[model samples]
Target: MTDNQGAWTLGCYGNPDIRTPNINQMAAEGIRFTHALSSNPVCSPTRATFLTGLIPSQHGVHSFLDPKYMMGPEAYNTLQEFTSLGEVLHAAGYTCGLSGKWHLGANMTPSEGFTTWTTKPDGSTQEFYDQKVIENGQMRVEAGYTTDFWTRKGIEFIQACKERPFFLFLAYNGPYSLGKLMLNEARNRHAAFYADKPLHSFPRDAMHPWQHDNKAFHNTDAARRRMASEVSGVDDGVGEILTALKANGLDDNTLVVYASDQGWMGGQNGMWGMGDHFRPIGAHELMMQIPFIFRQPGAIPPGQTCDALVSNYDFMPSVLAHLGLGDKMPQQPKSPGRDFSPALRGQPLAGWDNTVFYEMETTRAIRTERWKYVARIPSGPTELYDMQADPQERFNLFGQPGTEETTTDLSKELEAFFDEYADPKYDIWHGGGSKAKRHAP
Candidate 1:
């Protein structure tokens, strides 16, 4: 999984410029979901949901973890209280390994039942070269590019454990596509390819009114090139990993799930970064929609695209069901995700609700087939968008004459859903604290 990327950044997703042929090939040879979205719009929270199948409220991680609390005396595993994908798989007799960006905290040592861990010291990246990484409980700066290091480590782990059933969380931190780190010229091999071309894929529109972060780099040519370069670099890594899998004769049976932790906006809606870059925080489609592809050669049908609404929250349940480990799914703190494995095999999902919910701190949203309702805790600034007519979210229909009924219905459903799943101790709407840094107003 990539740090910050949009499905629109790949050629298979209709991106005209970005060089992501390897990922595009995965789309061509697998089941791609057009409406798969992240449950949260930020990094750490979404990653947490992807691993545990829990929302931010239930898991207690509402924002990106602070670096100061990631290691040394203060360091603690954020997901210690709950069971994660690695732990579940490990218990099912699979050797689990993580190759990059284990940003859930306690970075200095392996946590969550992962036997082989080589990860970054923190979540954010300032440089791709000579960066600090923690491997086998030791921290050191890598001499080569960070993306390649992770890729190489992932291949090595697969090779070493191919004799047994193994699960590799090959998390790539590249194509981060935000922060001060992107202002510098990309040092990867793909840098030269994008240096000359005008990357029209990254819109250079006027900044949005709510965009309060990463203002300096918005609409700049250097930043655009850097984003494209990093994305292509990740694509290169994907190619290498795929080749390694086939070379080891694990390609046919191994399920290759390609996805990003969350979505990123590169000047979309005139916003430069994610939902947190805004004052009230935005849940625009670009910030929520992600590339979700699954390939297992014989299991999933090739070249099939499903528009059934799905979220990162559903990933754990779906994978568990796919692996025939449905009986092993956590029951204590029930995950809201439903099994969408039927869709993977080109079969219709019976009783599947075509709706997905999103939460980021005080902001919460519900999206159905035709409408999107966004509600904020405490007082005001709620929004309702007619997704069918205005998918770009150009106008807010909240309190508008004809939208009142739709808004009210959506609001009630949103409330009821959260009421069922949200843990009161971590639900911001109920005055609860988050595990990570809170962005509540």
Candidate 2:
């Protein structure tokens, strides 16, 4: 369940109300992170950060695959020096297997240390397909729903490696569709349950320009229902994996992590998904703040909740620490994530920092224990919020008199972080800025 980097869209950590009884049950038994964040807002970039434990700028895959046209050949490649979590685990005598989406690169190769892999093609537009599984280094196609097939493959891999330790990455692609089949089901169910009441409505706080102009998936009850159904589907997939683990007697010994690639707006802040036409704004907690949970009954204490400021980059180190292989993992030059093993064990993390930073295409934000500071480009002003009073981020307090000192201090910290770890490749690609420009193709 290692969410990898998906934000609140998965309904696990960020959005507590999403139908995720399985994950909720896990959280009830284990800890649910209240303020964990991803280093980047986009998929490939954040995933790169997740694997390398470095920021997006440092990992160099700032945006998704740009193809060979405008950016040149190097733009299509992943970072050269950064090591992945799979590589580390494989090196430490663990059998590694990956199933489902492998957006890091469309071309499936052996560079990612996945000894066995069943991956979707790069930039795949198909929502469901018969995937090819790599068994003992041989590829073969298997048919089923994408999530179900990946779960089957993961279970098979576990059975094959039952005699030894293994790391199985079951990455699923669900609930991201813009289609209506699943949504219709949910709508019908809701209608049958509460026919008299007005259809339950979601709040529309701030609308992106596209959402304001479009009537398709933006402001429709169908869209909301569809999103809810998709979330439930993903949760169901998680439950399937959990069931398989318990059936095979691997539930207590294995460390399960559930997360998403990045957060989606889901019409909350007037956007549908992550990183489209809208300028990346760290406005809502749903975007930057993601869910992170760990479950290992004996190794990690049950019924724990940690309020530490963790990030996607922390995942690699945290897993390594849990497996007692931290010292054997590769060293990164500048990784901001710390091992939260103590917090997972229900011990007090007294000296842990309470601030987490999030950087997107042209936006940068710093979230402290109580305050959130965000700055966007193209004449957009910085935003500040008192999270304790306004958890939904309805109020912006930047430049206000009451929080001047806090803003100033956080701004300095943000600048220092960028100075140390800002990605040089991103700076070069975007002409020293992370802003997107309109140029004739």
Candidate 3:
């Protein structure tokens, strides 16, 4: 999994300029999901959902975890109360390992049943080269690039655990183009190739009116090149991972999933970063859509693309069912995810729901096949868009003549869904607190 990368940045996703041969090939050799979305739009909350199959309200992580509480004395495991993907897989006799960002908290040591851990000490990245990493329960500044470091550790874990059933969460913290890191040109191996390229993939639109962060580097040439270089760097790591799997003779049996924790915006709709970059914490399509690819020879058919609407919360359940561990899914908390394992095997889902939802602190949204509704807690700036007629979302239909019924229906559905799944202790709409920091109004 990658950090802050949208599917739009890859070649298979229709970016003509970016060199993502490995990822594109992976999509060709497996199942690619065109409508895979993140339940939340930040790092920690969405990562929690991906692992626990629970939304922010159920998992209690509303936003990116603070560095102070991620390590040191205050550090605590954020997902301790839930049965996470690692825990379930480990319980099923799989050797679980994690490499790269563990922004869920307690970065000082492994959590959620992972035995082999190599991760960054903090969630945010100020620099890629020579960053602080925790390996073997010891902190040290890695001499090489952090992306490569994670990839090497992942490959090593694979080689070491190849004899047994293993589950390696190779989380890459790359293409994170939102902070001081974007101010400087990329210094990785892909730097020279991107230095002069226009990289039209990253838009140079006027700044979004609600954009409040990373203002200076929003549309700069240097930022675009840096973003492109980092994406290509991640692509290089993907190539290495695939080669290692094949070289170790573990490609056919192992299920390799390529995805991002959440989506990112590269000047889309004039927005420059993630959902939190907007003042009201937007839930635009570009901020929710992520690249989701699943590969396993003789299991999932190759060159198939599924456009079924799915969310990150659906991942854990699907993988568990696919691995014949459907009986192990947590039943007490009742995860709001359905098993999409049929779609993974290139089979048609008879009654797959065509809807997904999102939440970011005070903001909540519901998206269907033809419409999108965004609502804020205890306020009046709700929005309704006819996605089929206005895909750009340039016009608002809320309070308009023909949209009242649609708006009412969607609003009630959104509330009902959350009311059924949200834990009252962590439900922000009910005046509950979050485990991590929040961007609440």
Displacement of the residue 10 alpha carbon in candidate 2, Å: 6.9
Clashes of 1: 0
State the lDDT at 423 in candidate 3: 96
* Per-prediction TM-score to the true structure, in the order listed: 0.99, 0.84, 0.99
Q: Give the per-residue lDDT of model 3 (tens digit) for 1-441.
A: 999999999999999888999999999999999999998889999999999889999989999998878988888999998889999999999999999998988998888989999998888888899889999999999989998999999999999999999999999888888788897989998899988998888877888798888898877888888888999999999999999999999999989999999998888778888889888788888889999999999999999999999999999999999999998998868899999999888889889899999998899999999999999978847889998899778788999998888999999999999999999999999998899877757
Give the runs in model 1 whose Cα sits over 4 Å from its true position.
none
Q: What are the RMSDs of all candidates, in order?
A: 0.9, 4.5, 0.9
Model 1 scores a C-alpha lDDT of 0.91
- Candidate 2: deviation at residue 113, Å? 1.3
What's the lDDT for residue 181 in model 2?
Answer: 40
Candidate 3 accuracy as TM-score: 0.99
User: Any residue pairs clashing in model 3, and if so which?
Assistant: none
